[model samples]
Target: MKKVCLLLLSVLVFPLVSSAQENTEPIVLLISLDGFRYDYVARFQPENLSRFIATGVAAKSMMPSFPSKTFPNHYTIATGMKPEHHGLVDNSFYDPEKDQTYGIGKKELVQDGTWYGGTPLWVLAEQNNIKAASYFFVGSEADVQGIRPSYYYAYDGGVSNLTRVTEVFKWLELPQAERPRMITLYFSDMDDVGHRYGPNNEEQLSAALERLDRELGALFEGLKSIDMTINVIVVSDHGMADIPVDNFLNLNELTRNIPGRVVNNGALAHVYLENEKDKKKVIKALEKSAMPIHVTDVDHKENYQDLMYKDRIGDILIIPDRGYYLAWGSALPRIRQNAESLGTEVLGEHGFSPAYKDMHAIFYANGPAFKTGLEIETFQNIHVYPLICKILGLPIPEDIDGKLEVLEPILK
Candidate 1:
């Protein structure tokens, strides 16, 4: 009788200890504000963002990976790998192995997990039995590593910012076991306005920033009402630069005779050659005609050694100088017409080398997990993945580029 009673007591005590451990794990909410430049706070001074920065840890600027485009940087933050390693080299890149192209506009391809490499944070969370939810991060819609967040919405730009915030509250209000320990939220307001009116357009850009700031204030207030420890981290994929209409480089006319396919991605272009011998000819033509643009063959192993799918990077890369837009055929004409109709000489663009200050994004964090009023120097965005994993007590994958030590100092 004594032995049986002891066994029953042990079982009950073990479960209670396990329950306490689970409940003590803090919740992390990762928010992305696309196209938010590093200097926007000093330029516009949005109230909520300002307060958040004042109270929590912030980097001077977050350096985006090379070819600082949307899809690549976001995926890099998600998996803690550079764009080349993650296999999403740009917003749109050609996969020679599959004989196909992947672009943000291609819905079927965007949702296909085969194109993405490395484990996204949501996938890591779910694999560890920690519930995760996403309101539309870059990789959230796809089933990465055969796993999707327990709660997620397909990418829908029409959804109101308030509605997304409301959904997050609903997710948090679930029972302890059902509530997600990790959540991702995204906002693209600044990106939209910046692209339309250019980053220097104070009136339109400030208005958008103010509106988003107000919504963030509301989100912060709502979080205070919850009893759990919730850490909020805000990041942006990349920044925007003003590209004048006169700065458009017509690559189509310049490389018309080249024996390869050129995929233009605004600030950068990728050239895939049909014949290996044609590489020299293609590079020569692009360099001669596109004077300001830089043309290089992909043979430089140091620059491409990390690429898991190197063929997707194309045989040659064409990078325009800062503030210059790379366009081909109808794109140039369409952009010209749009600029003419708008009466604006400048349109915003990115995908420049992160060396350009304007290509850097913002990083701010405030919550129980962070040290208040701490400011750090600029750090690469790749380090964020390990920081998030450390906060929630999730196991960090050994292969990620982000090191926990880099961001660990900011944690309380």
Candidate 2:
């Protein structure tokens, strides 16, 4: 009877203990550098980045979740949930419920709240009554769970790296009483230069990295002058890869008369067919094309179970085989006409799988509260939220898919 009673008591006590562990207090500052790669930090010779990694805990790789595009991965990190769980599976996702498709560029569609459908960390923090702030993030402008951050900036493509950094510094400078409990910032230039010139293009990439480094230096300097107790986390969404001119596959040529819309993401394309039969026909045509593209319906999870689900993907998913690429509509013609045109003419692009090392990004943390000079090898972007929760002394959200590792083993 005594043993049984003790076991019953243990069952009753466990949940309360777990809930108690969720709430605590330390500030978290999160930064995401768009298209920033895992190896580029040290390889590009960025002094600021290198210093941060050396002085803080740098991961081997953040290992982005599937559909490895900017918008999905960004939300994935913010929410600490997989694309399947958080529901933003791609940069541009299809909504079957409303029978519509939405991309980041279409602000009107965003206003409808069809594209995003998860409790982003900022909103989660706000709901918990913790003050949160964001520089810019996908779906951040949209009010999720009716919880907007204490402060946030809208996403603007024209915003320069220097401007973004300066704005972040301004917020960090706020007095302790009014300061946000959490903050997020994003920069996109390095990823821009990298996709155009390839990671090996030292000229453009170096300049971009240098510019980012200087901006980072200024940010660090600002933080130094202000209270240094803030815990800063730097990360990236996905990596980049170069597709050769001869390797390009034109979907228009493959599916000349297929009834569907081609949404291309450089090496990847999503063919949204009007009907199931049309999708099958498109798939058959793509398979018989010059360069093989891995085609799949997002609803069929087996083919792309590792990356994302079919419904969240598209009717016909096109993944260029290895060194090849699938181009749609005018983009295919543009790529064929000029190999350099696709990248150099534009800028950078990322929205591939996270399996490749080149597509991985950096994850590092530094703060007075963090364990000093420690390394965390077994971690993912999902782990980010739990660590932030640890810092702020708050209860981790029940809806959050991320596991709390505390990452104390790496701290000095």
Candidate 3:
């Protein structure tokens, strides 16, 4: 009888132990809705997003790093470092040391790991023996720190959003050991529509928002079938502002006499001088223009908060007012063509100073780890990295700019 009782106890206790072990590890799903503004929830009221806000913690806005463009801010969120520190100073920048230019369209340079700095979250996970997967996120394609996510796909905008959601579900369905503990997903629906139709176009913007929200609803519903505890975080790289076609400033025409190579990214431009002595001449010429703009030298540490890669920032920075866009003469024809195609003179853009509320992005999180119905104040996007590290029980690298204390209260 004693032997039979011991056997029964072992059978029952073994299953309990297995179950506990299977569910003990936490899972985090980080999602990015490109160009999602902070006030989008109140403005559009997408059904799924509204539900997400009510069920989890949210911020009035999430501040992006300077030059609030896609690549820099996305990588900043990943590595918890500013754009200057990460080496991706802008969407397109020239590295004097490498003597090469890095741009979004340049696949060769983008895939090279040497162009990036700071340890990405995926790298941290892989280094610590935790598995990570990314459907599409900046720096996921390039092997930062000589390591990429265990599972990832090269970015292809043609892939359907629903298909991406399906892939995430398949990742989660893997055997416990093979499943990734941290996963990142990206959607450009809002950004795409915003750029083409402008953010103020409610008809087009609302349609995009509704469709993306439905996909989020599907993702949330699919997680219900899984037994493990998972947390979902939704964030955006930056927001959008409308720019009138008449407001487009032709840099080539304005600064033809100025001696420098100007690389313009919509609302901001980096002026690289052929001679260091021309810095004053370039700034004076740029300032002489009657257009509403701010010209500052890269040496002004206050502008960028101590950039690690100052040379890449160029000798001077040119920023336009919120409703104005600075573009090269060569690109003006294309800009006009695009506006004509859309039948509107106004187009949406970002990459301006974050001081403008219009440049702020969104942050929303839901799952077992967050406190429900809690709304927090605006905070920097850099803090997101450490918060994610905390959720996965991973160690935060000392060099990162993010601090855990800022977001720790939201966690249970």
For model 3, the run of ten residues with the poorest summed lDDT? 1-10
Q: How far is candidate 3 from the true structure (C-alpha RMSD, Å)?
A: 8.0
Residue by residue across 1-412, what tens digits does model 2's lDDT show? Answer: 3343234334433333333223234667788888888878767778877877777788888888776688778888888778777777666766666677777777786544445666777877787777788878776777776667788777787987666665665554455556677788888876777766777677778888877787776666455544346678889988877655666566677667778776645556766777877666666777777666676666665745654334656677777666665566577666555545544433334556666666777788887766656666735677776777766776777776688754645543
Residue pairs with backbone overlap in model 3: none
Displacement of residue 97 (Cα, Å) in model 2 is: 1.2
Of 2 and 3, the candidate ahead on lDDT is 3
Q: Candidate 3: what lDDT? A: 0.86
TM-score ranking from best candidate downward: 1, 3, 2
Candidate 3 per-residue lDDT over residues 1-412, each given as its tens digit: 3343234334433343345334758899999999998888899998888998898999999999988899999999999998989889999988888887789989888888999999998899999898999999998989777899999998999998777877777776677888898899999999999899788999999988887887777677556546679899999999999889889988777778868777755778888888998888778878888888888887764756677888888788888877898888888889999999889989999998899898999999999999999999999999999999999989988988889999999998
For model 3 the local lDDT of residue 201 reads 93
lDDT of each: 0.86, 0.69, 0.86
Model 3, runs deviating above 4 Å: 1-22, 303-305
